[model samples]
Target: MMEDFSGLALPPLFGGHILETELDAAGVELTAGTTEILESGGTPQDIQKDTRELDKRKYQALSKRVKELEQVNERMLARLHRVQRLTRRLKKERRFLMKTLDTYGDDYRNAEITIPLEDEGGANLDGIPGGDDGGSSPSTTNQPACGPKKKRHRVPKEKERDAQ
Candidate 1:
């Protein structure tokens, strides 16, 4: 039996040798590829550099956006203050007008006297002592109504004669 097995080339045992050679070849290819990457300043360092650059750009963009938002916030606050001031002024004016209306309401109502439009003879003036007829009565006394009476200036007889 042993002599027969030695003469017969037993088919490759489960193809193990072929699989080992393939694995070795794959490992060599992987090593060469890694070496090439290492010669070009290594993958990790390149990735770190790229990450740093991206972070810098993002920070700049975010800072710029923050500045813009702050400016907008300031403008909005200014507008809000202006609106509040206007509202306060309007409220003060409204209160002042309301007080004025209250103060004058009674006087306005009392002073209003309506007369009939159909009175062609004009309003009756009998209640007042003075008549509607346009004339003034001569004063009974010599004293002025408003102030002290004025004295007449009399020229001397000699000056009057000389002037004549």
Candidate 2:
């Protein structure tokens, strides 16, 4: 395009512009020159530039990873809830077993059942079997019918020494 450089006014800051032109493949000539006065809308090419490439595999992998992580989190939560339930069940079973043992002790104390064995003096000890031997008395394993209040043993009484 042949630009008429005669009518163009150069701003005072840039002094003046020297016009130059070149022809394109379509025989349409293009002008090249630096102008001091700035225009409202400059070149259309200056608006934007594209540098994008498509990659579907990268997006698919990211989505798959997110889904897998979510599934793992769900499984962990379920396992934690199951563990809590099992722990509660175990504690309940333990308490029930202790209560059963206490009931057994009560039944024995009331003489609901009898076991046969001789005492230290060849006497038959009541309730449970396997009492102390005649020569050396065995340690007592019988729980008191009334049971202990504080559940602790006091120190044994000291034996007195005989003076000559």
Candidate 3:
């Protein structure tokens, strides 16, 4: 019976010739020294209470990590949604522009960036400005304005409104 340890699948019931239930501590996370256990009276309940406390601490740390990852995931999802919306809008705009170019390709290719020179006396095609009311800025002498011909007001996006 003493030489039959291979059948039990352990490296023999090793002990100091007195204790046979002692296990090797190869895979143990912590090994409380013999004197340390004796100082705590070696009570099983105390050992169990310590193990529970350790597990609770590990659980709390893992829970906090999971919450942080969840917040990051939410931010990533919102950014992804915003990117998808912008991509869709860009694709639609590109397709519309391509269609418009196909219809008026030659016109765009040949057209120069020149605003119809305001009437010499500042009288527009509408026959409306004789002199004082209709005035073109000296800064806008020749080159076309970068923006719209009229003072167009734009409705701001929600984010831009908040920023403002």
lDDT of each: 0.56, 0.47, 0.59
lDDT of 3 by residue, 19-70 (tens): 1132222222224533354468657888677666655654555465457657
The better-scoring model by TM-score among 1 and 2 is: 1
TM-scores for all candidates?
0.39, 0.31, 0.43
lDDT of 2 by residue, 1-164 (tens): 54555543322212332111111232222221112112325454442211011123334444654576578678889989999999999999988887897877755335565655444465645544675344433334565567677757765555533321
- Stretches > 4 Å off in candidate 2: 1-56, 106-164
Compare the candidates by lDDT and give the number of the best one.
3
Model 3 vs. true fold: TM: 0.43
Find the 10 residues in a row with the least total lDDT in model 2. 47-56
Candidate 3 or 2, higher lDDT: 3
Could you tell me how far off, in angstroms, the CA of residue 27 lies in candidate 2 after the best superposition?
45
Q: What pairs collide in candidate 2?
A: 1-29
